[model samples]
Target: MRRIMLLLILYSSKASFSYWSRQMNGIRVSGWLVSCSYSHFTTSCH
Candidate 1:
């Protein structure tokens, strides 16, 4: 019983970690894109 419970906990934690990492990656990509565009605009204006 304890072994099964441990396995379940491990599985759930791993699943949540993957999901969180994916979300963070998406946010980072969008942030990079926004910064790139902003720099391009500023350089073009000057």
Candidate 2:
């Protein structure tokens, strides 16, 4: 559980960095941003 949480945080941070960098991998960047927000909302809601 702890490992998973750590990985999620790492992945989300990397996603945010890529999104801001405006990488050409268009769809993926948007997906990451959306997923990050979704996770945040779910956790906050719970």
Candidate 3:
């Protein structure tokens, strides 16, 4: 019974960690893309 509880706690923590990491990675990628495009636009206009 104690082992099962431990497993459940570990699984939940791992799942939440992965979910948050994925969200952060997505935000980073989108921010990078936006910055790249903005820079390209500015360079082209000059």
Candidate 4:
């Protein structure tokens, strides 16, 4: 019983970690894109 519980906890924690990492990556990508776009816009305006 203890082994099964440990396995379950490990499995769920890994799953959550992957999900959190992917979410953080998405936010970083979006931020980078916004900055790139803003710079492009400023250059074009000038």
TM values, all candidates: 0.61, 0.39, 0.59, 0.58
Q: What lDDT does model 1 reach?
A: 0.89
lDDT of 4 by residue, 1-46 (tens): 9999999999999999989999999999998888888988777522
The residue-level lDDT of candidate 3 at 10 comes to 95
Better of 1 and 2 by lDDT: 1
Model 1, TM vs. native: 0.61
Considering only N, C-alpha and C atoms within 3 Å, which residue pairs clash in candidate 4? none
Alpha-carbon lDDT, every model: 0.89, 0.79, 0.89, 0.89
User: Tens digits of per-residue lDDT for model 1 on 1-46?
Assistant: 9999999999999999989999999999999888888988777522
Q: List the residue pairs that clash in candidate 1.
A: none
RMSD over all Cα atoms, model 3: 4.3
Candidate 1's error at 15, in angstroms?
1.4
RMSD of each: 3.9, 15.2, 4.3, 4.1
Cα lDDT tens digits for candidate 2, 1-46 = 9999999999998989977666656767778787888988767522
| Residue-wise C-alpha lDDT for candidate 3, range 1-46, written one tens digit per residue | 9999999999999989989899999999999888888988777522
